[model samples]
Target chain A: MLTGQLIAAVTTRGSGASRVIERDLLVTRNNLMVFVSGFVEPVFYLFAIDVGLGRLVGDVTGPDGGPVSYAAFAAPALLAASAMNGAVYESTFGIFFKMRWGKLYDAMLATPLTPTDVALGEIGWSQLRGLAYACAFMTVMVVMGLVASPWAVLAIPAAILMGFAFGAVGMAVATFMRSWVDLDMVNLALLPLFLFSATFYPLDVYPRSLQMLTQLSPLYHGVALIRSLTLGTIGPGLLLHVAFLAAMAVVGGIVASRRLHEQLLP
Target chain B: MVARGLTKRFGELTAVDAIDFDVHTGEVFGFLGPNGAGKTSTMRMIGAVSPLTGGTLQVLDRDPATDGAEIRARLGVVPQENTVDEELSVTDNLYIYGRYFGMPRAQVRRRIPELLEFAQLTDRADDKVTVLSGGMKRRLVIARALINTPSMVLLDEPTTGLDPQARHLVWDRLHELTRQGVTLLLTTHYMDEAEQLCDRLVVMSDATIVAEGSPRELIATYAGREVLEVRFPPGHRYAGWTGLDGIGSRREVLADRVIIYGDDAEQLTSAVTHSGVEVASMLVRRASLEDVFLRLTGRRLIE
Candidate 1:
């Protein structure tokens, strides 16, 4: 029976993970308006700031040798931010509501699924969503003549990695939240990360210590790595960013799964 | 199945005390109790959703502590609270749950329509669960539980919130499952439900089984062959009732009436009236599970 349950857990997680991915990608009738709604918010941000506001800011120096428009400079960062936001949204509020309000996990656990299965499935869905957003955003970047090389393809995987880090960390934090009021703190943490991750400007403008601090931000690594690749500025620094994101994914996954098991099973 | 000295404590509250019992295969067994009687807690342990604080329990000849997942896979459970996912359509709810049991997509596709029909939900298969009424949702939950075709089904207060019609529908489905040789374990506060569905039952109060027998056996042993109820005028008291001591073994004083237990209510009523006990109303009824419950616990069953 134990073996059967474990197998069932694996399959259930796989199906749940797939369902989450499909909910984002598929244009089902019930979700069509919501899908269109998500696009407009980011599109508005892209035009209002990247195009409308960039006219006042002028051109900026790309991390590489080339000079690029401010709009182009900010676009990738917005895309990276969107990736992070999508992942965190799915992992935190969505997961927390399902766990608490919907009692979805409780129902599943009554069957053969375990907390580990749920953690893996939720993270898997977030990563799949992250990759989808990255691909869509990259397509937009390419149409704007901002993507300079095939190297930009790496950003898709980079977005997925960023998703793993954020999703795992977000779910871990969600497990600690006792009510909806605690979600404000989650928003507080996210807003700052969005505004200060050098997503709108180059990090060199800040103090040396501030620059180091920015480098420590997970989004900064995402923005930096994607920024470098889109401009064909590949170097050893790519390896550092990749390693940081990978380590974050591994460590965050471990922490999230452990905490989830403790909370749900114990 | 066996549970020896099973106990569960949540902090300072002992939900289930040291209780011992066993359920044999192929019989309908009931845990009869009132609300807050530790029935749900004991069922949760048996369902393997909650661990036993201290004791030994085995389901299907396997320890639930060590083989919970395995045991759970073969067991069907309908919890007191409806845990159906509201976002999914009724058909999706069953299909997706079957996937949770590792049923092949093809098998689920084949079985989905039949299960929906069996649940009397074929017409609502495409509707989201949020749109369904309470009874429909509860029925959907039962359908979801049956997706894996379990050997044993556990129903905890299955009809607690349903209307009479919906309750009867659920009972019919349960009857079908039992007729197919599925072992059933049910808990309920309804004595009629127990009498109708249970081949055997255990009455629980304060977290322990106080009596166990078939419904009829309990009715005979605990209550008697028959019961006689005599209601006097308002504010009237029993007088000279000691003269009717030879009629039955027990008597109950209720707010509206006085109930006397005896094999012959007609003879008892004649004796009581002849003894100068003025009766405003009189009723004669056979012994029921409710009477057995009242006799054992010294309280009304519905209370």
Candidate 2:
């Protein structure tokens, strides 16, 4: 009987089919259309700056003293931003709404589904969404002649890593949410991370103290790693970026799982 | 199933005081109480969904605190509210819930068709739950509970908010499940529901068991075999009838109705009439679980 129950829980949509079903649900036309629409925002920013600001600023020197357009410089960072936004939307608002208003988690808990199952399943689904956004954005970059080398292949995993980190942290924050009012506080945190983490500018543009502060941000690691790969400027510093993201993923997964256990199981 | 000195405290409120009750296999045990009577709390503890504050509870011969997952696997829970996934179709709800118990797809596929018929949802199997009527949704919940064919089924106020027709449908399904030898435990505010369904019941009031026995046994013990209700004209007080000799016991319900309890309502009504009480209205009826509730709680069960 115990084995029967376990088999049922594992195969139940949460098993494998549900995992695929969940991710498939997130990648529907509306979500894909929204993602494509969001891609236009950053691409428009690139076009506006490269064409509009380019006429004023002229061609800028790459980090390696090569001729580089402003559009090219900001492309990978925007891709990283897209991945972060996707992860945040999925892990925070989507999760919080389901947990609170939708009563989805409540329904799951009534059965044998544990909080651990929810955390794993949600994180897994978020990762899949992250991949879709990363791959789509990367394909666009290639179409726009932004690919610098085979190193860009690494960005796929990097974007997924960024998403994993943000998704886990988002779930952790969602557990502490008391009301819809708290969602604004999440925006307050996410916006600052997006704006000041060197997504559109070089870290060297800031003072040494400010530069060090920006490095502490998870998006900074994501931006540095993806920007280097897309610009064909791989170096030893990329390993540090990978380590930083890996630590975030591990820590975030643990924290989110623990918080979910306390919130749901308690 | 056994609970010894089980208690639950939520913050400063004591929801369930220390109480002991045993549910034997293959019998329907009910917890009958008014709202705030701690029925849900006790059921939650037994279902392995809530932790006990003070005492031991064992379901399927396993302790809930340690064996929650294991015990929960063998139990089916139908909560008071409709917690069925409204987004899913009727058949999908059963299939998914069956999977939650780790049942394989092939087995669930086999069971889903039968469950849909059993719940009488064969025609609506493909319809989303949100579109179903109140009774249909409740039947679907019961059907979901049976997907794994659990050893015990826990229901919390299963028929509340349902119309009489819908309530009877759910009752019929429950009767069928119990007839198949599934141990059933449920809580309800309906006296007739408890009397009709439960083989044994615990009458609870203010977080404690006020009485416990079979429905008829409880009625005989606390309220008697029959009850006589006597009413008089407006402004005519029952002051003269309170300690009347030869009447078994009497209770005034509002200013109009006076209940007289005894073994024989005919004898009691004749004696009251002979005593020249000048009654304006009278009803003699067999003592029901409601009278037993009123006798123990000093109030009507519904109010």
Candidate 3:
């Protein structure tokens, strides 16, 4: 996992982040509704699009330019968005409350854990949640007969990668939040991405300028990568999406660690 | 712990100016000062969590700047805030905190029961921290700090917000830690708490050390042996009373009382009465660290 590499990237004392994950696991054992609830939103979107809208919309052009059912086209993008949400929700609201109210990082820093450990540990937890949502969503995809090819199996890891990118970036954003009132901006930023990042429709539906703008959304790369994998449209062009997500994850991780060290230790 | 010209600055504000001190092993050391006297800042530097702005400092024989995690591994920190995991059980907080120091699972498990007993939270081990009272939460934070079996412990205003009974209980627990030879470094503005807990203390005033020694020594060197308190009626101009001056080594005239500091309170009180000054009541009080701070800084500790 990238978490192992991230740990070595910032510190020699990386076990502290694992300890944070263990604490989160113990806390989550009480209110599993949190995870179930996060997993439900995208499923609802998937069902609404598949059952209600797919009948009216008919087939759409897939990545291979072949005609495919609307459900089939939207399913992979839904999975990618869900992965991003699972991680972002965990990193944003979760980090905000724990840092400001719970004072968990203040306690951890008093021990041997560096800010890098706390950052990666929190991201690692979100990534796990994202993975769970991805797996469950994939299972649903298979049961619904939405999975197109054997390559769809690779979507799970690709979904986790999406989670890491959004989760890291979300954490970096969360560090800048000052109060609960500041949390409204998270919704402001995420709702537009959820609606406009090629999640519900193909990028072709947009005008030329809007389509170009949509590509700038990080979630767009996530959706495109997962969609390519699930559609079995194998090509070297997919490397661009991977590079974007990876770079986002690295930059986000660095900024988050640096910002957190300033706040927690300053 | 050793600090030489340690300093801390926040933008244009200097929280802790150049100050120096040494903490001996196996003793209860205290930073005695009012709010914003640089006590917590110094404590943070010793905790290895806050970076010092200037000067040389060492904790546990290691430089905190370079070896923070390693230095922190051997140290326990009870921050001023109640930093316990409100969502977790009392025992889970301890287990997870011990794991933060990389303690083995089995060892942490074995240590938990004894620690709960030490903290007097054995019955509440499975309870949520939010359900516990503030005193119980304070005890839990203290117990959690001990999970690593640290050689040194840093407590920032440990009993600041506690009620009298809770404060006494916390003091008792600290006494036990000192008896076990854990090097405890604490901060407080309460003279009684410092007198009860600290073997040696430094009086911090305006971001610098005004005095340092044992509690008795600070009282003797700065305060003297006893205080002669002369009380009068409300709105009385007691400061204009004749024969009040030159009766003792020093004199402090408050709104309602005149305090005469001297080695012999009996003679000072007798001299005040013999000078035809009307006194409603008189009492000889033992000198305390509060008086020492007031003498050095000319401000009340709690005010």
Candidate 4:
């Protein structure tokens, strides 16, 4: 009987996820420009870092501690950051508007869809968008000769994992927001992570204390994981980064779903 | 649907205070109340979205606490606000809402045209929902609620912001749904709306039900068959109210007018005029649900 109830719950959530995706598909179909627009921000950042900033910074130390072009070193980090950005933007601002102003979840909850379904469905959509951005950024990386090894193909899944981790956590944070002003706090948290996660320079440039603090950021794990994959620096320590991100995804997803159930159901 | 001692408390404040009511299948049941009178709260509980704080409530013979998803699966809801998907077209809004209910794409496609026709939105089917008039949007919302052919539909102030023409159009569509054997539960402050649409209703005031019955029954009980209104000039205190007392069954003195309730309005008017009350104007009309609401609550239905 317990298993039967569990299966029933799973099936209901599965249907809810599909329903959310279906609604997003309709929204994207109508506003194709907005769907296409998400691709532009990451590309702009990639160009700004590689062409503008790289001219001044020149070469940096790669994962193997060997000298590599500044663009080559920053490309994978940008890809990781973009995956994070795509997921966070979609899950935070996107879900906030729908939940608060649009009351979209209210309408959905009036149907058979539960709040858990909404969280899962939104996270799924964000990952899908993050995957697309990751693929585009990866292709650009290859064309720029940033791909140092065939193992870089594994970076796509790593990017997806990165997306899921950030997306889940972003959604959990969004459930607590009460007004538009609270959104600035999301930016406040994200900007430092993007700048300090070794995206613009190597972690060795910072003091030991600051470097340790940098390692504590979730984006630091994502950047290190993808950078090692693309730079072909395969080490057993990479498992630690992947495990950290995987744990974040699981815990954050559970928290987001539970918080959504509490807020939307009441 | 049945609710016994149903209560909703938001922190220390009670929104719905131990209300008892029952809604049978295929009837138009109304929750009539002014703003903040717990009508929306009660409707939300019946819709299985808001958890009941205290009481026994059953919808479709299932408990909403444990079976909200199941109860919602068989229910339709039109919220007080326009929760339509503004970014999507009219067709897409209905299509996606249907999908939310787990309807198959083919079935949703088949039903869209029929729903559009019902809502009088066939001509604007491909237009974005943001451009539709207030009335058109409301009609589309009503049509979207029927996408599942639900066993029951809950409308929270279905026509609160709509103009008269739009309101009539929505009422016509709702009436059609009732004729087709759909159970409807709606909340409204408009006494005329309640009298026109509801088979039976409960008047709510200050978080509790003040009265419950058919519109005519409540009007007949709380107010007489007709009301005589007499407005003397401002600041004129008529000492002749005792002479006008026997003309009607009961009399209510307002700041602007004196309302006399009686079985016969014409006789009461002549009697009031004959009493030499020096009235500025006198009018007699049939007693309505508004009178019933006012007499029970000591407050006007709208204000």
Query: Would candidate 3 be rated incorrect, acceptable, medium or high by CAPRI criteria?
Result: high
Write candidate 1's Cα lDDT for A1-266 as tens digits. Answer: 53455466567556654543343343233566654554456656777776679889888989885688887788778877887888787778988898888888777877775566666666766665566567777887788777777888887887787887788788878888899999888899899899999988898889999998988899999888888877778999899988988887667666677777767764
Q: Which stretches of candidate 3 lie over 4 Å from their true place?
A: A1-14, B238-243, B274-281
| Candidate 2 vs 4: which has more TM-score | 4
lDDT of 4: 0.88
Local error of candidate 3 at residue A175 (angstroms): 1.6
lDDT of 3 at B22: 98
Instruction: Evaluate residue B232 in candidate 1 and report its C-alpha lDDT on the 0 to 100 scale.
Output: 76
Writing each residue's lDDT as its tens digit, candidate 3 over A1-266 gives 54566646447645677888898899889879975887788789889988999999999988888888999889998988778777787889989999999998999889998877888788778877777888899888889888888998889999888887888788899999999889889888888998899887788988999999998999999998998888888899889999999999888877887788799999
Model 3: per-residue lDDT, tens digit, B1-303?
Answer: 899999999999999999999999999999999998999999989888899999999999999999998999999899999999888999999999999999999999999999999999999999999999999999999999999999999999999889999999999999899889899999998999999999999999889999999999999898899998888756555543544878899987666677789999889978887877667888999998888988899888885
lDDT by residue (tens digit), candidate 2, A152-261: 99999989888887887777788788888998898888899889998777788899999999989999999989988887887898899999988887777667766776
**Distance from true location, Cα of B3 in model 2, Å:** 1.6
Return whichever of 2 and 3 wins on DockQ.
3
Per-candidate local distance difference test: 0.80, 0.80, 0.88, 0.88
CA shift of B109, model 4, Å: 0.6
DockQ of each candidate, alpha-carbon based: 0.37, 0.30, 0.84, 0.79
Give the true-contact fraction for every prediction, in order: 0.52, 0.26, 0.96, 0.85
Q: RMSD to native for every prediction?
A: 4.2, 4.6, 2.4, 2.5
> Residue by residue across B184-244, what tens digits does model 2's lDDT show?
9999999999998999999999999989999989988888777888877666656435534
What residue runs in model 4 are displaced by over 4 Å at the alpha carbon? A1-12, A47-56, B237-247, B274-276
